[model samples]
Target: MPEYDEQDPVDISRPNPARMYDYYLGGAHNFAVDREAADRVLAILPETREFAMRNREFLQRVVRFLAVEAGITQFLDLGSGIPTAGNVHEVVQAVHPDNRVVYVDHEPVAVAQSQRLLADNPYTAVVHADIRDHETVLNHPETRRLLDFSQPLAVLMLQVLPFIPDTDDPAGVVATYRDMCVSGSYLAVAHSLSFDYWPGAVAEAVEMYTKSTHPLNLRTPDQVAAFFDGYDLVDPGVVFTAVWRPDKPVSDEEAISSRAVAGLGVLP
Candidate 1:
């Protein structure tokens, strides 16, 4: 891990969604402010941690499928949070050492930690940029070096779109990235479900996030599916995060308890 000094640009006073997510994943990269905010969300919804874990599991499963089954060698992970276990490069490189990956994030901690972790791996790199800025992320030297737009690569947006409010045109953002790739390129998305789908403290939890660096913008299933407009969804299209091609059997209760929806699509 990279050392964070006083001169670092990270603001420990405010809660960051990436750090809060790291806290939920039991990662040590988060600060007290993030923990307090995450704890508040956990108090409101005890299953928040479970949701985070499920989202990570979903990411691993999807990336593994893309690398091994779909035969994709390049990956562009947008809004990738603090590097945790089973990251995209780890999962893909296990299949083929040369598998390339570019991780994009605006969080200083996430970018720094990723840069440190990926220093020795020439096949991977970290781009410190906001995912919504498709031009910046796509044009970054690392992204251009590691990912080829003409080839079939997987673009991952797990648990990312919620941070992009509708006012920013999140669907258009996806479309922008999608248009840059070839027909066989893939798009994987996992987003928190709207309060209507998950009644109870979900609204309150979202309200709590409003105070954080990235405010949560939960969307309906239809709204989430709109991101895959130009692509054909894979089997079991747009289902609960835990139920999307789970490596292990998922109980009905576990599926219902999942607070988010996930799906993988291929440009047809």
Candidate 2:
């Protein structure tokens, strides 16, 4: 972790989206308010935890593919929640110890926890900044130090875009990052997608996020794909989380129930 004051305040009064996600992942970094919110979401959608885990799995697989196949040695993970099993650095570094990663998140507690977890890891660093502030995130010392823009890199926004509403120009935000990277750089994105299979459950989950710090802004597959406007989507274009290069066979039921879609694209 880069040297910096870790005195950022953590508001435990209201539920934080990141902490709630940590709670869903069965991590101990969450507070009571987070757990309460997570439980309510679970009540509305019994498969909430399953969806979260599957999304995580998708991220892990994408990281491994980029590291081993694409030969990407650096990663910028936006909205990387409380680090859990199969972190980007963990997955990539295991394949190539030289891989570097920079995690960006606005949540104070999330940043603090990440800082602690990566204290001894020189190749990884966390930036406590809103991903929407592209300039700050791109210019951060840690990011500049660890990532080489001149070379190919992987930018991951899995399960994070829904937090950015349309008014904020989420698509433009993505395009800015895309333009910043050199050609052949990769962009891995996953956002909540509502299918006909369980519209009611999707509505309930959306309602729950409205009360949290980051409201949900679920998008269709086409809408999500537009984020990669100038990039070439990799094979198995934007599909359900479990259906995206899964390690094992995914049943149709499992694919539809995942309720999230992911895509990998390369800048041309």
Candidate 3:
């Protein structure tokens, strides 16, 4: 096992995206700075917290759908934040205990939390790696041990793409994972959408979060769907977070993300 120590924290003085997101989800792993920043973002866009919850629901729905219907037992959750509420392993393992899950994140706190939460559970683990390093993530020790590349796996990029700038090849990051797993593999992804929902809502939210460690990169619907080029998108293709195979009927409140979008794609 590689020594999972602290990395280059360019500026730990300000709020971090992962930590701010954790704060939005009501998780305890965040700092006061993160909470303050999240509060500011919420002030700019009241729907920020609402979108987070809906995204969580979306993650659970997709995990269960893959585990039960797709018969996928391997899951690689990229940019997975602090474990809270309904997690991938909790949801999938409930359906099939043997299901294996590996969460990858560059956030130190997130990696630590993932380790603590999954220590006794051999089937699930977390690795510290950047989303841009697709090759390293694919070959990570925890990931290699828990996931079988030859079998069908779910590549989860939930609400993670926006963290990486288009200059870093965000689409390429997803396509790399898509091409690695075997033909029956699946992909579940969601990205912060552009300002289509509320004229200037997206841009305003981005401006609010600029104080955080990373700058946000919200994408348009067309740009978001392009991430699924190699695979066949499942029904209700590339729709808003609540619209993708929603577990329960989506209320007007849940469907608010005519702004953010999500979908699942199957390889074959």
Pick by lDDT: which candidate is best?
Answer: 1
Ten-residue region with minimum lDDT total, candidate 1: 1-10
The residue-by-residue lDDT of candidate 1 on 100-195, one tens digit each, is 999999999999899989999999999989988888999999888988898888999998899988899998889999999998999999999888
CA shift of 116, model 3, Å:
0.5
* Per-residue lDDT over 1-268 for candidate 2, one digit per residue giving the tens place of the 0 to 100 score: 1233446677767788888888888888887888988998888887888888888899999999999989999999999989898899999999988799999999888898799999999999999899999999999999999999999999999988988988999988898899899999999999887545354566876687787777878788889888888999998988988999988999999998778889999999
- Model 2 misplacement above 4 A: 1-7, 195-201
Instruction: Quote model 3's TM-score.
Output: 0.93
Q: Model 2: clashing residue pairs? A: none
Q: Candidate 1: misplaced stretches above 4 Å?
A: none
Kindly give the number of clashing pairs for every candidate: 0, 0, 0
Can you give the TM-score per candidate against the true fold? 0.97, 0.95, 0.93
lDDT of 3 by residue, 51-72 (tens): 8887888898899999999899
By descending TM-score, how would the candidates be arranged? Answer: 1, 2, 3
Candidate that scores best on TM-score: 1
Instruction: Please list the residue runs of candidate 3 whose C-alpha ends up more than 4 Å from where it truly belongs after superposition.
Output: 1-11, 199-202, 251-253
